[model samples]
Target: MLNWSAKRPVIAAVAAILALSACGSGDDSGATGKKDSDGVITVKLGVVGPKTGPASLYYKYMDQNFETFSDDFEEKYKVRFEIIGEDDQASPEETARAVSRLINEEAVHAILGPPLSGNALQVADVIQKSQIPWLLAGPNADEAINYDIQPNWAFQTNFTNQQIMEILGTRLFADNNKVGIVYSADGFGQSNLDHLKSWAKENGKKLTAEESLQPGSSDANAIIKRFKSAGVDSVFMGITQGADTATVTRAIEQAGYEPKTIMTTGTILTNYKTIAEPSQWENIQIVDPRNFLEGGDKEILDAVQEATGEAPAIPTNNISTYAMLDIYAQAVAEVGDANDREAVRKAMEDIETVHIGSLTIEKPFTTTDHKLYDDDPANWLTYGFDEKFNLKLLGTAEECLEKGC
Candidate 1:
């Protein structure tokens, strides 16, 4: 086991060596990266995401990890990945174009990202038709993946909105709490609203108010006052950007009204803490599949920070990307041929478990289910932040509800 207390130095040293080894130039000649005579199978992977657009901040550590950890993964799995990145500009239209190009022009063996749920949906059909393994490390909307589709090519490494909402709804709607939602007026927020409404309806909970906030909005005082007027004791935020989340929090603080439960998605763990006041962060709770708290997965977090000299802005996505690569690499190794796309896809489906750094995921993917994390409370961690902006573990969703943290 890669325990933080025992093997910190060893992991750091290994990551450093790997970083040094991957300093060489890469071949971007659009080759298939077929198995060479040296017994090394090269996997050409198409990476689609917003590399230079507004949502580019979400993938800061993705390309960095790919560059820094190439040697480490290749050494173990005997698979060298030739990464081809496509900038989708965080747009559905751009995502369609990028996916098409990767399928036709690049001829990549596998595809990863187009991180937004809306973007993923835009190209889901075409990518599935291409028969390439689609590695979803970011988007969380349940609709982004369709397990009913035969030979399901999409594999989600991130927890879906349904999974997080189940945990959030249980806590937020408990004790006859009057809940209100403030979601961004975008696809991400729309998905959040859809899931929230579904959970509420199934559980017979009533929402006090539902407000939509546009991205880059500077003020949310009106929304805050509306919630207050509607007697909303709990607030569920589905905003996409951390800055927008901060704006809402700032408004709540300025209004001098504190909700009992201020629950939200992993956006709180993003740049929200940096921009929001410490007081505004009070009563906030977030449910995430990967525990980025101090006592959880510190080894990988430390290793990535050590190698890249920067902490991951979106730790969940960063960690998911790391695990996704490990799972994909293992699939390729099991098939023993990266060129055989169908075989690799099947291998990915049958992978029972994988341990990357300090995280061990059992049943990462199976034939019937393609999601890496489910709605199990045991697989999710609930956390609150301290005034100092450090993650304070409340516990698992079950434990947190039973005993206050």
Candidate 2:
């Protein structure tokens, strides 16, 4: 592995050699000058996310691994890639502007992320007009598909809110009939609440209590009190912020209520230990895409650590980013032209199954569906803490989907 931080001289030398190699005896007439007489094609790929905002850590992991991953991919597929990264600062308007720059200015063949749901929605029009293949690493809401705003060229690597809530509801409802819900007032929280409602109705169960708290609010005592009053046996949390989930957990404990509690994804696994008391976390179940500490591909984990000098707290986010690039590389190699965006889009649509390291994606991309792992329960995992406060994988979403509680 090339440690760019410690071995700058080696990286500089490699870059010099690659630059000389790219200057082949060919007429440089195009904007990107990507075509060479030797038939070696170079394509630019853009990545957009919150690299400097509150969620910068997630993008930092992806940025660190991109160079090494692209290098290896080029060596294996014989197609050169020039990766470009942009920071949206977690703003939707900035995301749209960044997309324009990537497509019209940088001439990137494909793009990854814009992490947040609202940011992805803001750029849907730009992506559709450019026909550039866009892979979203976050924004697990279904509004992208439900509103028909997501273009045919875009694909979501994360599980949608509907998929996650359905699985969680099914599992919780199996043993408890009096289920209460506490959600944020934002789009993501509301979306999960709506899905849970549908799942409850389908399972012939009624929501004992429901509470909606505004984003960034710290007062959760009322919500907890309401659930307690309703004699709820189980409490489902739809809060997106980690601190908020922690706040609610604290309230639940303060109220001296010990009902089975479940939390949604995006609750930073690393921060949970500090956010809530050990006893509070012990009774909490987390619905997540993958376990960060014990559930990722070893090889990919090593690569990320080597690049970032730290292990990712949420391995699935980084893994999904890596998977998206791998899929793009596969399409470029199969299409035989990195610059032909149309051919690459079609190639991705035709892909049935792909294995990147230890992670497997079966028919993840298709013509009608842009959501990867939407109905595939294997892609989602449930996690809980042991008696000793150590995290453990409970089961896959497939169990809940196949046999609802």
Candidate 3:
């Protein structure tokens, strides 16, 4: 083994090289497509996310969908796709390096990934400067982009914090009920809390209690006890992981505090069912752009199961990936050249309507609006869980707000 003194020079030299390379000029074409004599265009795409980490579950089934759906996409659009994946481990530092390598070395036409809001924030400016099409399938912070900037290169397939809070706020604040929140002390949770506060201010309401939980915390009894003391009638969770949400759920059951409503985002649908008892999930509800219960996305879900011989571990994210790829393929075809990053970006913004599987999006994109789903309560769906933790459709957000589901 090398001595510490001997290793110092080598480590410093490698760091210098990486720093210089990151600042160096790369291919100006920006992952241009190449056409072969057979009249086929090949586009290279870079995928960034945690392949192995505490958060790896968020990336599950993404790669499989890429493989299972490629042939069909190629047949329809006459364009072939080539994917280059980089494992960021869901760390901001690793995410920065992975994004740099993808943009500077991999030369990808577009990039998707770094599901967490914090990781996404780490590379936002560099990606925007690179002028690459950024397909945001995760990370819902409204601050992800400076909205004042025109001709934005990034587009969001995930709902923003503001959009989700708009729907949840109406239900949680109905009948002037006292509300309490328990959020993870992380970027995702912080953003959700900030939006919730804004929603309350705009609507002239007040939250009775607020608490923060660290990731992987094993207990939330104190948080639950505080909510009880505050006489909170509704409980809203802005936690990042399903397991953490389970901790809160278990605490609520143990303390025998029955809030009028228990609500959270789709993150609860990740692993809460497996970690918490069926009874703990009794009155829990969540709002999402897509419905997972009763197979609202049955057509694509069934196809993926048949192709892979198993169901997606997280059906909502898998279907989001499917929709994102479809939109990317459509843009490439519309531009007639994936090599022209600017053209492809513009094409993506102009897509008015897109239908895939059982999901149909109207005006999915526009020059000024990049979010796949807007803040219209009508566009959001509400869901509850059954005794077996299966998704049960509640109603549209508008209907659910006016009348209990």
TM-score, per-candidate, Cα-based: 0.90, 0.82, 0.89
Score candidate 3 by lDDT.
0.77
User: Which whole-number lDDT from 0 to 100 does residue 219 have in model 2?
Assistant: 78
lDDT of 1 at 114: 77
Report the C-alpha lDDT of model 1 over 253-286, residue by residue, as the tens digit: 9999888889888876667876888888877888
Candidate 1, residue 274: the lDDT equals 69
Stretches of candidate 3 off by over 4 Å are 1-32, 293-296
TM-score of 2: 0.82
Give residue 302's error in model 3 in angstroms. Answer: 2.6
Task: Report the number of backbone clashes for model 2.
Answer: 1
Global lDDT of each model? Answer: 0.77, 0.66, 0.77
Q: Listing every candidate in turn, what is its Cα RMSD in Å to the true structure after a full C-alpha superposition?
A: 4.2, 5.3, 9.5
lDDT of 2 by residue, 317-394 (tens): 666666666677678878777667778888877776554565566886656776666655676666777766566776
- Candidate ranking under TM-score, highest first, comes to 1, 3, 2
Preferred candidate (TM-score higher): 1 or 3: 1
